[model samples]
Target chain A: MYGPSIDRLITALRVMPGIGAKSAQRIALQLLERNRDGAAELAASLIDAVDKVGNCSSCRTLCEGERCTICSDSRRSAQQLCIVETPADLFAIEQAGGYSGHYFVLMGHLSPIDGIGPEEIGLPILEAKLASGEVDELILATNLTVEGETTAHYISSRARAAGVAVSRIAHGVPLGGELEYIDSNTLSLAMQSRKVI
Target chain B: MYGPSIDRLITALRVMPGIGAKSAQRIALQLLERNRDGAAELAASLIDAVDKVGNCSSCRTLCEGERCTICSDSRRSAQQLCIVETPADLFAIEQAGGYSGHYFVLMGHLSPIDGIGPEEIGLPILEAKLASGEVDELILATNLTVEGETTAHYISSRARAAGVAVSRIAHGVPLGGELEYIDSNTLSLAMQSRKVI
Candidate 1:
């Protein structure tokens, strides 16, 4: 119903994660009618980022340089390496402002049905990092999902065999979570892992 | 927390309507991580559309040439001109498959508070078209807002002065809307504008 360029733009907008036909149409019309400058800036930024950004060589996180800022930072402990499923997870931990350690991004967990295995997730690079003797403590910050647990277990064993201590991040009720509303599985985990406070 | 290019891309993604900081980050990361080719295509499309698309000279709707397809089509009746608020509204009317007349896009309604006058909405062009003696009827398909009513009244007065019959699109309960759920203003309008069976 729209001109060729506008139609093409609406179709192209559907490539984003959650955008569907109606949303794509709204977005395309909004950009064309209201904010041409913003649209141009978005286009330039997309081109710039896509052309420049790549995985950090050391940690496999998205970055423009050879190493991510976290990987290159000298103050963060090299003795401890936190394993996460994605760059977004790495960002969440950084935003929480708790850990002051290096990180290794797995990008995804082991999902054999989808053909994602250890090697697919760059586990050999992680093994090499473990064998490097620089990391003494391997922190499992991957999610508590089944695939996450499986990947963590696989990596923990490899790290232990390489003489590195391994620890999994706690899984239970969140800090402000009410026990009554918490799921049974989480409540069970919390009860079983009760600490002597 | 991210590299320069990635950070720029995230910030740029916020220009999109309804995209917040978190959504922007997710979109940027998803594009960079999962579909670089899609990202590149979106960028190319945005640039192409922005560079080529312009307002149709006759209707002021978005198009790549001198006139929009509706304006250029000889089959559409030039005697019945529809005045709409935006190209999106024009597209909506066309999609409904009822109107087969030329359109004049106001782009916006008359808003003195926002300093938008008739001239700002290209009323001079509309006046010239009304004076051309070709259009016998003027259809006001603007929104049901107060501003839209004011603009429609203003244009209707001008059409009357130029000896053109004027009509406003009906205002009342939607086709499938129940009377119980309908707003009082719309219900009152529906009551006043009732057609005898």
Candidate 2:
């Protein structure tokens, strides 16, 4: 009832996914309880992150420097490229390890109803990257949703026309998954990926 | 991330309740995607809130100022004090427009296993406030949970010994609650508070 500034904080926080009025208030209170230095560090982080993050000119991954590390690294094999819908997916794959290949982040998946076109979400840039002849295999690491499949097929057809091999990442039942807990999409995919036992 | 700072931001965000590693990463990237000014504003609010909120000197409610509005308001009847376990509960009551009395916040309910004692959570201050003879009626608005009921009963006994009138908020089945979904305690309360049938 006192500070109107608190309302602004709550409103800003509520704009984020999953945070409701109660959570927004709690987060605001937590923020107000911390010391100035701690608060400043939080503010400084927001400024630093937003101001620093930029597109990696070579790849589409978020970068602070001229190019992303994976994009510029000499050790990474350019012939094998991983293409994901977002920089987040690229980061997820990187965290999982064992891949020393180059990456081309699409930054978004195809969605017609949302009016996000291929060029709008950086698919054409990926096409050019494939056309450079530096990549031999283009791995489609997009989500296993219907849109992702359609986008993968589109990319594959176009990339194949340019003489580059393309492959979609497996989206079958997860490792150690119980059949009862499996979703229809995953179950269908697992069935499609089945091998003779 | 191109910078270790991004990882640090994600780690810091993960400390907040309900935020997982993947969600934290998504939030971090979302902040990066936002304009620097917007992110800066959000960060500033987080910083500012943490810097301002302090416990009210009188009622011990968390506030930005010395005394909470409930304690400072002239129109509110301070002679009839309502005590609750949390600031959130007080806020909820206020939002519902049900009460127009002063409030004493207990921060949390009593829990012996958690090492929380009455003295440790400002019960002495509350006793002193009650003994001051300023409050004529002390309303116990603690939740119906085990610890809340125990704390409320303990506080009520002491208030009665001090010759101050003590009353608890009525309990019953919530409005719009389905009878099939209602629990035994709620059904019992509903029966006890039954009016014209």
Candidate 3:
């Protein structure tokens, strides 16, 4: 057991994703022993980010301003809007460097069992944007999980009702992936979605 | 890419031990998305710990007051002093629940290449404690690394000069370790240090 403050620090650090008790202790001890300045800077950064950062009004992604960089960039296409479950997913797409469209972050998917519905994920705002007729195509870039598929299906119907074309990001064997190592579901999807050579 | 504050938070999170860039990003985003209150608490805890926690005047371990809990405990033996490389090592020994003596945390070992020496590890304070004649036995519980052994050897000589009985913690096969799976170095040490049954 450590001092009260150290114990509190270790407990607080466990709030981060994937960090457990031992790791929290290790991090706390490491900060206190070796990098107190770094610890102080991290504290300042966390406070600053928490105090200033909020969801982008347009895309619902975490940002310090009204609009995220991608949403505010005029060069990106207003015609195509990609829907993602989280800002991390949006970041992944951005890192891949293939998409030039703006993103709409759901922050989470529709989980009826968990009582997370359309309103919880700001679907009304998305529908309002769709109704404005600014977005001509809606790309569903949510994860490949069941919740993601269900969310995509629900949004696709909304987009169709709003007279906007909808498309889902394809899921199959990844680039440079060996078919022998790929799962049967993905293989089946790859077989079914085969296009003309 | 995320906004400036989000990016700064991610970068700052990387200051913790074992947290790389991707982990930092994941932690930052998870905190922002799911646990803003937890994030703020962690920030507050970090500031509180950094501002308040300092080395124990007696043992050189991180603590809030003039002395660490172990150093201030009157019931614990003053006749035995255990020297450890860091407060983490001291905590590990405490968690094992065997030792009941005071501790002197070195905070680090004799890392010569890094310009760390006796004063860097608070060896002078340890020597002063040894000279005080309160401790009859000195236990070396630093890590089993080269630097740790070097530090132990260096301190043992000092303790010997101060007329204190010294002993090193056993280095051998662990309690559940199988000889076939054990490393040759540990097995050799186990063989050499074998006690008559």
DockQ by candidate, in order = 0.83, 0.41, 0.90
Locate the minimum summed-lDDT window of 10 residues in model 3 chain B.
B1-10
lDDT (10s digit) by residue, model 1, range B161-190: 999999999888999999999999989989
> What value does the lDDT take at residue B101 in candidate 3?
90
- lDDT digits (tens) for residues A106-175 of candidate 1: 9899999999999989999999998889998999999998999999999988988999999999988999
Over 4 Å off, model 3 = none
Interface RMSD, prediction 2: 2.7
Score residue B13 of candidate 1 by CA lDDT: 89
Native contacts conserved, per model: 0.82, 0.45, 0.92
Q: Docking category for candidate 2?
A: acceptable
Q: What would the per-residue lDDT of candidate 2 be over residues A1-197, giving only the tens digit for each residue?
A: 63666777787676555678888778665555433454567666766777677888887788887798887889889999888877788878988999889888777778889987788668777788877888899898878778888888888898899899888776677889999999887798789889788
Considering every candidate listed, which one attains the maximal TM-score? 3
DockQ of 1: 0.83
Clashing pairs in 2: A31-B49, A31-B50, A32-B49, A32-B50, A33-B50
Using lDDT, rank the candidates from best to worst.
3, 1, 2
How would the candidate models be sorted by TM-score, starting from the highest?
A: 3, 1, 2
